[model samples]
Target: MLRARLTLVLGIVLLAAGVAGFATAGRGLRTTSVHVGTVPVELVRPDGAAAGGAARPVVVVVHGYAGSGRLMRPFADTLARRGYLVALPDLAGHGANPQRLTEAALDRDLAAVVRYVRGLPDADPARLALVGHSMGAAAVVRAGAADRSIAATVAISIGDDAAAATRPGPRHLLAMYGAFEPSGIASTTEATGAERVVRVPLVEHIGVLFADRTHHETARWLDRALGHHPQRPVIAAKGRLVPGGLSLVGGLLILIGALLSGRTGAAPAPPDRDRPGLRVGAVLVAPIPGELAGVALAHALPNTVTGYLTGYFAGCGAALVAAALLLRRPDHPARPDHPARPDRPDRTARLARPSAAALARAGLLAAAAFAAVVLPVHAGLTDVAPHGPDWWVVALLALAVAALLAGAHALLGTPWSYAAVVALCLPMPVASLIGVAPGFLALISPLVLVLVGLHVAVCAAAGRPWWRTVLAGALTVAWPVAVVLPVLG
Candidate 1:
């Protein structure tokens, strides 16, 4: 009881600190939603700038693949504080945009944004610049090469596409990359004949976006290219990320602990009797079939990332079901009132299998807790809320995820089953990273591991049953897959 009380108090404090930190970072910024045709955009600038004020130099920042305008908020905020009017847009198929994206569409959408920004009353049309990361980097590099009017270009995490933009002109190209990035990334940028190149140290890929040095370097380069300097010091807020993450973990600890307190009696838990070696070995290969199925089926789906996820979860469900059938055994009588004996703490003793009502409660608790922690952070960091046909995808994916979790519980049992969960979930994303699945999976795969670890740790601490834990875990993992991936018709 005392430990739980301490946890509750600590969690509240951390959550408050994180929320306050994020709010403080945005103190002098004004953000508004505007549209370029059907494309949604976030227009960010200094708070006190008047409605029809003198035109300021505009910098349109674009996010990487599977990312939204919000994901590029760090860049937007930094440049806005430096007195640059920044425009962050949801490319076709990403964030709030309702249109599907394609190879040709990326350029078209970027062109639209550029044209619209050039027309903004507060924008200096002649001094327009672009800053893009990854896929967006490729887009801007191509844009800068083709359009002589673009005063400057900043490309971060650029790929082979940079080599293709070979238009030779007086382009003020600034190529930025993490030192830890692949060697090919540097060579590609160099091929563009960038006037300035920066390799931000001790970071790679996503880290480059949040790095303080990366933000500073980008602002400085743009200021030089557009020939504009801030009258005030550059405003930076990368420090808020650490406390925000801490707040998420703390909030989860409180919610899971409180919800599962009924299952975690005051008495100490008994020791495990199951063989650790056998379970570990079984779990290692358990997800292989599902991964194979998902990878194969993903090729046929319209929505690249979400399509792969759907197939992946379905494959996992099938594998879990097969494992359950092969490992079926007699059910143990309820031991709700009994303290599990140390030597016999296998499936029957530990699982004790909660009632239907209890499972429902657990599912509800997990969903609520997962949403509280994940949704706000996701919205602030990435895209807007899922809408229109997105809920249909969420419903379907949730069922498959639930099946995968339930089957995992049946085979691995209640205690230490998180290892199995991680093993089952990680392979598809890795396959994607290596080009076996949709390449975009690399963007979302890390989140899978983080969410899985979070769910396992919180549930384990709260002493929830395998079924209940799986229920919670399924919902927690599924929501991101549904919300983050692009919606294609």
Candidate 2:
């Protein structure tokens, strides 16, 4: 069992590593780290190293606001596979770059990246291309306008500044936006070979680089504009994203196998008495404390990422205490005549067996489910809470978090179990507001609320009628309840 648990954990870590390793793989391209004074960058070159290689066509990719260079790896990989030297950099206040970030600093850092790419030994000065996503969009457009040496520019999801992005183009320009972009924003085409593509399905701003349409069209435009084509079509590249996903699947199976085999460490718990009003009241009332605590922490903590993280961590701890205290049953005076009695040996055995194992298994399964769902989405949406994370760093950190949660489950009851599981999620709403990252609470609120509501109904079910009420409530109002915070914000 210990060996199997270790196997499952290690498998999850390896899966995440696979996602990263495969994304950067191409025929002769090599990714390396370089810097220009204060700014850090990833230089992807055609051969082993950029040094001494002859000048080649260059493409510089920049990430959006609050995002790091990793978010653009897919796009960088595609361009590099086609033989273009790629420069992926973390703008000021992002990735490994400087922390004292401002708009002016970001602009300066981008200019430096352009200079680095153009000055590369094998870079083709005349075949340079500049690209950016979201906030990086405006930066790229401005950079292109200032530098005629650039051969083309692509801005994914640029807004109403069509003239700004297109008119100052370096021979060719392209704009790409997702289907859900605001009304009145449409594709663009110009006589100077400028064009736009819109309506890429099931994608939002964070997903621009991951979309097939973005890669294919962007590659085609680059080849045409730079007057270079790959010797062969690119395939099997996206297979890289598969391993991490599969690793998660593997972890899920191991856990399911454990639970099904009845290796759960704890005893089964008796169901709670049915209280339909209490169930309704819990879901309706939970968010107030969650959000209010979040807002309070936001102000109390220092205005920095470290502070942001501290406040959220503290908030979770506080919420755990609050939930435990609020839901605790009051003690009654014992009758003088009554005395406590020891349980029978067999009854003690039965109680201990299912309680710990069952709880641990359920907690582990919930955690595994979260990793499987969120990390793949994280791959596509690296714009969320990114601060230049390494391949195995988050995996290891998450393990520490799980261990901490197990401690909570040991100290408190199952209600506290659910509280700890959801507590870490509260910081996202405030984080989104302060611009550390985006699309966190907005995306997971519904899922979390549904889980909370279901926990309420199932655990508290008195019988069939009460169970139906809980299920009906969970189905009917979960979405609206979950999305309320985002709507209010």
Candidate 3:
């Protein structure tokens, strides 16, 4: 009863906080979605700007790898409120754009969006600025260096590309990063010898995108570079989303706890013949074959986020198979002509079979959680809804995730063991992913870790048995990946 009460009270408070955060993040700005040719662009402007009035400075905010126009909302709102028109595009192989992500394709799509925004009736083409984060930063630096018309450029968390584009740029350049970012980021930013190299303290790669100081500094830099001055240059706080997001996650965990504690009786543990040490060893060593498989298939896939995810899923599946084989029991002795009596249904079968009522309840819970988390993030942070081919990708990936999770549980005989393996095994796969795919993939590693932790928490709370928890976790993880990662052909 106490758990139930906690779930009720805390969930309500957190959800309310989340709603409030989204409501106030960009309260006075006008945001709209439009197509600039084939590219999808999100345009933000000051609410009072007239359609045919005097032009405003245009700042094109570019998203990093696996990011969308919506992901840069904080920056867009900041610039828009300061009387600058902000155009954010979903680059090729990201968000709503269906094209694959390649250097050439991203360059083409970004150029097209820049031209489109520059030609807007309310935009001052002469006062254009470009601000990009990570992958977007690299692209914009290159773009700004190539085009002298761009008056200012802000590259946040840029990579080595800054070095090549560093020389001979007369325009204003500010290379900014989070203090917590890797040393390489600082080195590259400093190498550019940009007009200014500022680090926003107490934030890291993705956090910097939403940091209050980042927004303030970026808007101020752009203002000075473009010769625009508002009556007040200071920005209102945009950090409400931080606590709001935390509240939502906290609420979800509490609710899961309530469900776990409310159970009338403990579920029976499944039969396991493997020794504890062998099972643990299997889990620990699972990633080796996965890495090998991922490396082998890397060249076969496109270089987009979706492609990387496909490789990830493949690697996970390989790891699951390896672990299962390692934990497989030796056959019992039998007479020469007679085969051993058929054993009970395998672990996979047990995991695949859940009562209809349990499945329905798990599905409903997953949907509700999805709405609670994705809706607010989409409204206030980024584009986070699956579209087009991404829906199918979500389904396929969910199946793979479910199988791997259920297999791990069956082999290890406990959710905590599976969690231990995940925690230990995550870094290697992430490192391999960065090595083979986009460097910006490294920026999202922390998010992936949190996601896996959330999944384990959910399983612990919804501890009916293996199948329901696996289903819920698989759906939750798969949906976000599908929504955030691009669909590339």
- Scanning candidate 3 in windows of ten residues, the lowest lDDT window is 297-306
Evaluate residue 35 in candidate 3 and report its C-alpha lDDT on the 0 to 100 scale: 92
Residue 129 in model 2: lDDT: 91
Which pairs, if any, clash in model 3? none
Residues 224-288, candidate 3, lDDT per residue (tens digit)?
99988764464643644564575557557555756756676745555565477776676666555
Q: Give residue 219's lDDT in candidate 2 (0 to 100).
A: 83
Could you tell which candidate, 1 or 3, scores higher by lDDT? 1
lDDT of each: 0.74, 0.53, 0.71
Q: Give the alpha carbon lDDT tens digit for every residue of 233-318 in model 2.
A: 55332443455356544544444334334334444443233353443344334444444444554434222222232333334444
User: What TM-score does prediction 3 earn?
Assistant: 0.85
Clashing pairs in 1: none
Better of 1 and 2 by lDDT: 1
Residue 266 of model 2, lDDT score? 45
What global local distance difference test value does model 1 have? Answer: 0.74
After best superposition, candidate 2 residue 416: deviation in angstroms? 11
- Which is the better candidate, 1 or 3, if ranked by TM-score? 1
Give the TM-scores of the predictions, in the order they appear.
0.88, 0.64, 0.85
Write the number of the candidate with greater TM-score, choosing between 2 and 3. Answer: 3
